[model samples]
Target: MKLFLVRGTAKGTLVPRSALCEPRAPHFLHEPPARVEFLNGTGAVVPCVVHGSPPPRVTWTTRAGQPLHEVPGLRHMRPDGSLVLPPFRAEDFKEDVHSAVYRCLGTNSLGTIGSHDVRVRAGERLGTLSV
Candidate 1:
């Protein structure tokens, strides 16, 4: 596509190649694995890396399409758009919270795209030593 940089009422003629930028659909740089296994209390990090010409907004949701907001100290989303399930105490482990499927939605003016389902599983940490 041709791009013209007009100045005021003056007509633009030559445009630099570097000025050639276009809006495009969001593309995932890297997505979370199908399943993630983490030691209980250690938690996990589910990444949803994505990018587009105009940049995109990121959001996490359940399999049923419910908005998954951060649960105080339990979970949070990083500035880089990665979901962080912070480490927790063994007694605070919740089956529903520790093990579930999540979807990452990346949206921009062009459109929105969703990452594949990411299922996280938490395992009990027996003793300090891991086999």
Candidate 2:
């Protein structure tokens, strides 16, 4: 990814000074799976590994462009680019989070890239009974 360096552009838009190599757009190192399933009240993690010349900032969002953090019970973990889905009771299930397709975006000075869609859902949990 070459920097156009247009006039009046912010200096921060250029490649990081610490980076020695040429600027490169973000690419996925490890993409999230097609689907992630967890039991009710059990949490799950969706990992998205992205690498670039100057390191990109990863953000999670739904396929519909809704930010992952905007969804209740979902957390965007920093420094690792992983989405954390917090545990919640069956009655507290949110369709927006449980039945949504998520995608991770890696953005940097060079460019931005998006990961494949990943569907997240929580199955009903059954309790054991002793006679």
Candidate 3:
């Protein structure tokens, strides 16, 4: 028996199947986080979703240039790329360190992409007085 193989054509050129498929770079599937305000002693979440051919690593950074992993128990990145900020105590507000901008970065073999700046603010609860 005799047989022949056929290849796909693109732009009038015969192309191999392998050449037709290429890996796509990472990209944001949804808009980045926006300005969010959380009452002191309340939790907050920032969502960041990305898409790519090989998937990507998600990282979070604070306005002070501190990495999320270094923040200890105060903040962390969820499995789904959401930044979780746990409830802040009154003392946390005193230094105004918890209130700052946050940024999300996605990285893959192709390249790296950054999300829009997200401003996170922690404010004192209503009717609460500082001693």
Candidate 4:
């Protein structure tokens, strides 16, 4: 008898792998938090947890379905199940943050899972700023 490994991707189709080749494991959501906080001057930070026979490749995207670019202000964790936002600046809030959205992506040899949409906003002040 002989054993074979099958691999798959979002595009479709599966291929066989040699015994030496590492098999792709299914990426599962382990401890992904439902909601997170966006600090007053700090950007949003969401934690992602995943486990499987093989670790998963993690990435992030905006709610609007935009890919997160590798920049100073924005950042993400690799195979680990963690995320970070370097630092938030005024320009990051200049945009329409009211409609901003955040999401977590996890992909492994087996499959992938994404977190729910995370909305970011500026904290409210009790008293109004008077001139």
Candidate 5:
């Protein structure tokens, strides 16, 4: 009787060949951000978590389809998949253009997934009353 053995292509490696396979599509851990609010001159953060076999890359974009990083000092994407919005200035409140919707996108070798629309509202600060 003859015996057959299955060996991995690489030598001296304990990792199974299947472990190097491509990852599955990304999925959300929970419902993506639907809306977020912030006061003028205050920073804002929106969290977007995702799960996948090999991990996915996270990115942010505005509702108008503009990349978040291209917004100069206003927007930044954190390593933990959170979008950061720097404090707004008085000039930003004049046109109301700063209050816009955003979306988080996760992509891997398998496919891409987009989070729900997140409306960011930067409300004006109320004045204090003094006697």
Candidate 6:
């Protein structure tokens, strides 16, 4: 089993176990897209990326704690270390679109890491209204 030490919480911080530290489990980080553009009538396209060490797994999920694959209209693609969305349905888009919470999860044989939530929106261009 892999060993992990979580930090940065309200519970305060803990000292690093330098005596028992090991470098077997490579560090992992996610490179999720900072922004996503939702065009008119086409669908939403979200790109999830991963950074840091290799051999990682990436997936998405909803704020309701529902698995992404279980959610409709959400398509996931695994290519290299990027998650591609061919297209999303209008109906499904309604669920995760506009102020909805979508999370990108990355995992490796050693541990798992997730990126900041990517908010989906329905608009044309930044600061432009869709009519």
Highest lDDT against the true fold, candidate: 1
Please write out the lDDT profile of model 6 over residues 18-45, one tens digit for every residue.
5235333323343556555565445455
Task: Report, for all candidates in order, the number of backbone clashes.
Answer: 0, 0, 0, 5, 0, 0
* Clash pairs for candidate 1: none
**Model 6 lDDT, residue 112, Cα:** 70
- How do all models score by TM-score? 0.78, 0.72, 0.69, 0.55, 0.68, 0.52
Residue pairs that clash (backbone atoms under 3 angstroms), model 6: none
Score each candidate by Cα lDDT: 0.79, 0.76, 0.71, 0.56, 0.71, 0.54
Error of 5 at 57 (Å): 0.8
**How do these models rank on lDDT, best leading?**
1, 2, 3, 5, 4, 6
Residue lDDT tens for model 4, 1-131: 45544546575544544443566554545545655445445555556776554666677777777776655545555446566654455445433342356677777767877777765444422232111
Tell me how many residue pairs clash in candidate 6: 0
Root-mean-square deviation of every model: 6.5, 9.4, 7.7, 9.9, 7.6, 10.9
> How many angstroms is residue 89 displaced in model 6 relative to the true structure, after the best TM-score fit?
7.6
Cα RMSD (Å) between model 4 and the true structure?
9.9
How close to the true structure is residue 1 of candidate 2, measured as C-alpha lDDT? 42
Q: Candidate 2: lDDT over CA atoms?
A: 0.76
- The residue-by-residue lDDT of candidate 5 on 1-131, one tens digit each, is 43334556556445545554546798988545687777667867788987786798888777876777645566777898988777877665522235777888888888888988888767656452111
Q: Return the clash pairs for model 4, or none.
A: 24-109, 25-109, 25-110, 26-110, 26-111
Q: What is the lDDT of residue 60 in candidate 6?
A: 71
Clashing pairs in 3: none
Could you give candidate 3's per-residue lDDT for residues 1-131 as a string of tens digits? 33333565454555555544456677998646578777777768878998776688888876665676735557778899988878877665533336677788888899988887888766677454222
What's the ranking of the predictions by TM-score, best on top?
Answer: 1, 2, 3, 5, 4, 6
lDDT of 2 by residue, 1-131 (tens): 44443344566455443354668899999988988888766778888999997899999887888776645455446569988877777787777777678889999999999988888877665342111
Q: Give candidate 2's error at residue 28 in angstroms.
A: 1.1
User: How displaced is residue 73 in candidate 3, in Å?
Assistant: 3.0
User: 4 in model 2: Cα distance from truth in Å?
Assistant: 28
Residue 124's lDDT within candidate 5 is: 59
